[model samples]
Target chain A: MSEEKHQHVVPYRVYVIILIALLILTFSSVGITSIELGEYTVAAALIFAVIKSFLVLTYFMHLKYDKLYIRVMVGFVFALFLVVIIITFLDYLFRT
Target chain B: MEHAHHVEHPDMYDEESSKIGMWLFIFTELLLFGGLFIVYSIYRYLNPEAFHLAGEELNRTIGTINTVILLISSMTIAMSTTALRKGHKKVAIALVVVSFVIGFAFLVNKYFEWGVKFSHGIWPGSEQMLAEMSQGEILFFGLYFVMTGLHALHIIIGMIIMLFTIRGLAIGKVTIKRPSMLDNCGLYWHLVDLIWIFLFPLFYLIH
Candidate 1:
């Protein structure tokens, strides 16, 4: 095996920690579902979902180590997310 | 201030461009799904009772297990990419294969779940079955099958790509000198896994 080129690889322990964090979020989201949070239920699930997605993208997909241009591109995509959802909601609003 | 030659292929750019590209693509995918999720949310809000009934009929346990499997497979793919960056060919190959196997396992589990649902007259637009149910409930399952079915198709495509990459490595075409191919394959696999991460909570954990 050639000498490892990059700095020492991130330890598996870190990834395990991320996994634990996701599980905690998952359990908490499920726990909150039964509560009468009213409209907040969707918000809660989306919040946890966003957190989990961030963890996966940053750690598993190596975005944390990526360059700034990449970050900007990803940010732009997320910005589009709002536009798409809002427009969809507009359609829903008109129908109702 | 005079490192002009280094500007052409800086380690930062070279090491990260492919990943950035993958992120951009994933962003578009999220937009596409964001549209779908918004639609789902709207219809569910409009017809809460029907949505709840559909939710009650779903197989949550299987969905959770699949989510766990996909998450672990993602970790393995991350390890594989890291391994390759370090020129650990054997470990990288093994990890890739492991991820592929786990992905296939997910598909198999999903296959049976869908099969059961289909047999139970819960398929997309099964009028003979959903004739009495609210239109929203039928539409909910329709979108469910369409979204997840598209995802599964992507998984199948990813599996085939991984198998080819594995074969490429077996034939000495995927060495460090030509590592971009493997990197791209890993990106696609991770995207598939990422989609499943979102899908799990959406279909299974609906309130």
Candidate 2:
């Protein structure tokens, strides 16, 4: 492996940008709670939550700089997790 | 001087390997908590009324503050790793200390919040006092206690790990040439923060 190729630097500006993004997300989540969006209120909250999670995972967590295999492993693990969630959901949704 | 040369072996796997190992550990952690989430979701779906009503009793402000604290800690820990990688040892040490102090603050807040709830008889099977609560409401508290309790355990473990990292920095066992110790510690700390990110909404936000 080329040492120079693997060595990378993250600028300070990136941290400030992510901080602003998280603050915006937090405010929006609190603001949306009051709107009577029916059942979709939770759905909307989750959507923003997922976006915020992505920002933290990608930038703050540095998963963005990881190798391809590591990324694949993370994706596979999450896919398996979704399967578990889905199976449980079906179990509750179908009710014996 | 002899020991210094021994620790500076360039052929050793770099910081990236340690970070990958930490991530793989977190992968297992996800599944461990995923099992609990599976149970929570199934019960919540079956008892929507109970879940929503129980959720309303939680302090939204406390949950929100904890969320911001965890998020900021994650950012600071990330910057800590960045500083170590750039060979800025003093900045790196300062950032790690900040993360540790913030983490302690989070646990202190959690202690008070949980203490108040316990005083109000919000424990499992405290049916005489939880009489106003429904059966599913009891289950909600059960799950809440288990999930957040486990997360708190992880935070304490992360703090212990950070302590060792700090000691390593002080003794010069860790340096930029091999910064994986801090990187791995940061990875573990970030996972603790990420878990709370999900927990905050699940317990505090209900529709």
Candidate 3:
């Protein structure tokens, strides 16, 4: 838990590479959604959005280089959000 | 004078705790936006057609350009951290300045985008909306304004933080030895970009 162990500086090259990947993903998301995927449009777009956020989180935000607890907390928060979404939808579905 | 060491130890800067504090605040932000996402989902579900119609009215080209702007700015800010850490003070400040410029570009694009909508009389409570738009369309535009407005607010705040960090870097307050201020600022900016990643698809692309 010492701060000395955590100064792992990310490289500039790595940030540039991640930026290219993000731009490609952004363009692909737009392109894919342009093709009429019908009901799957939202799903496809959301999946791309999720992947983009993961990259931004893991690299740009340095979660990959951070402590284990910070990672765990972030995971838990996202999981909690997913559960909330599911329950809300379920409640919506079962309504009379 | 003998107690000076203990006093300084208590005042010692700790990056780990500082980061934890930031993450905690970020979690609250997640919850705040999560609530909005939930509301959006329910509304869209209740009126899919209206959501679709209103979503189509949005300009995807501007949305895509803004997305790229934000993504590039995010990278520049992240690279600024690396530059600062590597002791390239001038490069670090330069990258941050690039971020500031693109951030302003995004804001400018948003201004015009919102301006177009207003010219079309499509704001949340405009009379044209009350007279002609369906209730679902009203809800769609309402959420659109609120969600994007809040996000733009975050962008402004992030730019302000970057301004301070830019000053810190120039003045030697934010240094390689104590870089939490700049690091935390990067985290905040990336979060804003992350939210836009989702918001772009939800409000513009997924339609």
Candidate 4:
């Protein structure tokens, strides 16, 4: 573990770039809401949000550099969350 | 020599496992909010119009401000970790302090936002809301208050963690070689921001 302590020191420049990208995405989402895209408005905003969270999780949270097991754990948790959401929505959508 | 002897015990400093533990705790936090998000989706589907109306009542400007604030704070916390790793103790502490200040600003913004809502009689169980709002709209406000309120509570908790991390840095308990506490705190702060990333769109930009 100690040997891996020096693991991947991401350059400050990369952090800055990611921050800029996130801010740009944030503004874009806000702008898209005002454009009257009809049904796509919510979908667009949420898509931007998903991208922003992806950046945060991968870079800021250092998941990209984390151990394989940790990555697997995150993926598993997300899968479980998605399953729960889908099943619940199915129940609600089909309720007679 | 006592300090040197402490280093001999490998169990005393397992940064990898400590980080794994933090990640596990973070998963639980995600699921905790995931449940509320599920409820929100169901209610919104059932009452889209009411949810839209209720979302309109929220101040998008304030929400955007808070979003930017949290995003910048997230960057600062991340940079603080980098600074600590680079042996810039003072820079690291200053970054954490900056994040703390921004977090406080977020709460202040929240205070005014909620104050305006309360003054308008939009609070849960208010006679105005109960009498005038439909069941869906009422439920929308209820979830709004509960979800954002919980998120705000997390902001406070994250600040407290930062405070302790700053103290640890000041006293040399946290150092370049051993910064697991600071690192974990940064992860926690990022998690708070991550949650808000979703919350902002769901509640504010629902157009």
> Which model scores highest in DockQ?
3
Ranking by TM-score: 3, 4, 2, 1
Candidate 3 residue-wise lDDT, A15-87, digit = tens: 9999999999999999999999999999999999999999999999999998798999999999999999999
lDDT agreement of model 4 with the native: 0.93
- Report the CA-based lDDT of candidate 3 relative to the real structure: 0.93
lDDT of 2 by residue, B1-207 (tens): 456544665676656667777888999998998888888888887898989888888988898888888888877878887787777888888888999999999999999999989888887677553677877888899999999999999999999999999888878878877777887888888888778877887888764
Output the better candidate (1/3) by lDDT: 3
For model 3, the superposed segments whose C-alpha errors exceed 4 Å read A1-6, B1-10
After superposition, candidate 4 runs with Cα above 4 Å error: A1-5, B1-11
lDDT of model 1, residue B4: 56
TM-scores, one per candidate: 0.85, 0.91, 0.96, 0.95
Per-residue alpha-carbon lDDT of model 1 for A1-95, expressed as tens digits? 33336534656677678777877776776777657687787677678778888887787766676556776777777777778777877887888
In model 4, the Cα lDDT at residue A69 comes to: 89
Across B141-201, the per-residue lDDT of candidate 1 in tens digits comes to 8878988998999889888988888887778777765665677787777777777767766
